[model samples]
Target: MAGKILISGGSGLIGTRLSEMLIDQGYEVAHLSRDPDKFSHYKTFRWDIQNSSIDENAITYADYIIHLAGAGLAEEKWTKERKREILRSRVDSTQLLLDGLRQHEHHVKGFVSASAIGIYGNSGDQLMSEESSYGEDFMAEVCKAWEAAVWQIKDLGIRTVILRTGIALSDKGGALPQMARPVKLMAGAPLGSGKQYMSWIHIDDLCRLYIRAIEDTTFAGVYNAVAPHPVTNQEFTEALAEAMHKPLVLPKVPSFALNLMLGEMSDVVLSGQRVSANKVLQTGFTFEYNYLDEALESFYKKHQN
Candidate 1:
């Protein structure tokens, strides 16, 4: 029989691509969503992560469970209530799945979970690796809790892998498009000091990293899902402007202005840490687009006329 994979958050950007990629690779793919009707994929199922209710039948006889469900960190203002929801969505949904795994005690081949490089906090100039210490920030706290929740699966003797994802670059509903919008209008410029590192991965490479983790038995523990080359915010903005054939003479948004506009959410915009993908590369995963320019070019070709 072909491998059966269960995916949470399959409706989101990365999950949608990953589900399609897995199907193309001849794996049996099932996705967990709050509303299955929104997606036309035949493999989708309903699961209310907020209520801790999951369709247990979906995982029966499955070979792997790739959990990608979570509240989008950058989706809304970081109000106190919204922050709680963000953390609970990831941690609770993960616990719900672990509960099901424990109840079934089935020998699932692996449990792959989504994490973020935000756990490293705002490392000014340091290039972060898996061994780097967690930073002292709200996002770092959330990631720490998120990973801790997934760690429960280990007690069941199931192989669990956590992907500490970086900023994902794609034209379709990702950070790139939002950033590109301002630049396309000739009002686009860098954020903050423009010195903060933006460790990012092409959407294609990120999906492949998840697949590699699920299939490769030797892949355990955490891997940074970022491109081999990380660029500064200034470099990223300039490259994006060049790709869109726009002039890059606009002034950057100062950090104080961003904070005034976005409140706590400004941290995500004004601060970034460089992350290394060497571990994933060491495992023989090749990135299709390693450089920011190449990645931006592909996005422009696809989305820009």
Candidate 2:
């Protein structure tokens, strides 16, 4: 085993897989959760963000920490209350971790946080890099504040790395499963204009990046965690249909219908930016699946049985 690693929101789609990958690589993994008992296999520590409380041992037992706690952005309609929860769940939980670190004298080595490409908003076909301008939308603001909270860890003299992740494609549970369903049933089509670029990464590659952040001392600052090649929604749909051996015959899903059904969340699917992987690649990081077709094929091949 290597160093002890603690993850906040370690039960989510990315975190669950990350914890397993870290374990398989001989690093001990633990989780920060509201209910510790729910995760019997791992050492679980409790943290109630609204209450401003975190388990003391969680801080003391970790050599490194990865923060991935956040409310689902597209799970429901964006009401005033829901917006507050979406923002607070990420910002406040991070603040709670900082608070926990302050209460105890700890020697944590590094902090890796998960940010999102939503910060770029609906950039159409514009190529987005880490230094790109921030979008002036609800989700953009949420991501901005989320990263701002993570930046506070740098003051403690710990090297912090922030990854502005794009759409994470995993067969287990993520955008891929949802996107693949209608295609499998032969109803898949382009969403909206289908020109909005989706910068995405395979789950296995993303887990490798997280592992790299922990092991590589120079992996600091912000990097866009996406594959080198980005694709349009139409291209993505076509590739997926090809991967599953299904034919794409349906017309493009209209923007108006999607807007009516998804409300503000429709923007998540209908709008996207072509995010760059140059920064991470410059750091010598490589992707296992760099092309959209290959990534979709890999996922479908594993689950076709």
Off by over 4 Å in 2: 303-305
Highest TM-score: which candidate?
Answer: 2
C-alpha lDDT of all candidate models, in order:
0.89, 0.91
For model 1, state the Cα shift of residue 173 in Å. Answer: 1.0
Q: Give the TM-score of candidate 2.
A: 0.98
Q: Model 2: per-residue lDDT, tens digit, 1-305? A: 39999998789999999999999999999999898878467899999999989989999999999999998876779889999999999999999988878779997999999999999998987888899999999889999999999889888888999989999999988798889889989999999988889999998899899999989999989989999999999999999999998999899999999999988888889888899999999989988899988888887877567
Flag clash pairs in model 1.
none
For each candidate in turn, the TM-score is 0.96, 0.98
Off by over 4 Å in 1: 37-39, 303-305
